[model samples]
Target: MTSSQVFLSIALPFAIIPLVLFTSSKKIMGEFKIKTWVKWLAWIATVILVALNIYLILQTVGILK
Candidate 1:
């Protein structure tokens, strides 16, 4: 895979998943935990990123156009 694709599929998820989980975890962030709206937004973004990564994988595998 290309370097950019590798970064997006692997590195980006590694960074984003922890960021979303940590920011949303009250136990981790305490009073500084992300607000509800921001948490939802982050979750939505994470979902979109995951979807895009799946699409990229499919494309790389010739399952997608």
Candidate 2:
């Protein structure tokens, strides 16, 4: 993987985590709760991150090109 991919792999999730927490937090989800759309988007993003992490590890180990 190139430097940019490596940077994104680390940065993207690091970036999204705070938003996820904020959106799902008790303070925000208490009264006017998180919308279905937001939840689905978060879930999809999380899945993508998991897949990317797996791919990056495999590439690091010479299992992927």
Candidate 3:
């Protein structure tokens, strides 16, 4: 991917984090709180996504050389 693509990939997840946090609230879930396992999975997924984005950035910048 190009620099713009790498940037967008990183930006999209950064943007989604706020949306996810917003949806996890009592306002969205009402009486249904987010489960521990689900939260853990989300955290893990976020970490992996971030790592991928960082790797993509490094690759695009030729830092992986």
Q: Candidates' lDDT values, in order?
A: 0.87, 0.77, 0.76
lDDT of 1: 0.87
Q: At residue 39, give the lDDT of candidate 1.
A: 90
Residue clash pairs of candidate 2: none
Off by over 4 Å in 3: none
Per-residue lDDT over 1-65 for candidate 3, one digit per residue giving the tens place of the 0 to 100 score: 66689769769787767755765677777778577677778778877887888887888888995
Candidate 2 lDDT over residue span 1-65, tens digit each? 58787777767777777777778766866865677788788878887887888689678768999
Question: Which candidate should be chosen as best, given lDDT against the real structure?
Answer: 1
Output the better candidate (1/2) by lDDT.
1
Residue pairs with backbone overlap in model 3: none
Clashes of 3: 0
- The parts of candidate 2 lying over 4 Å away from their true place are 28-33
Q: How well does candidate 1 score on lDDT at residue 6?
A: 55
Name the lDDT value of residue 20 in candidate 3. 59
lDDT of 1 by residue, 1-65 (tens): 78687566966788898999998899999999999999999989998998898888888878999
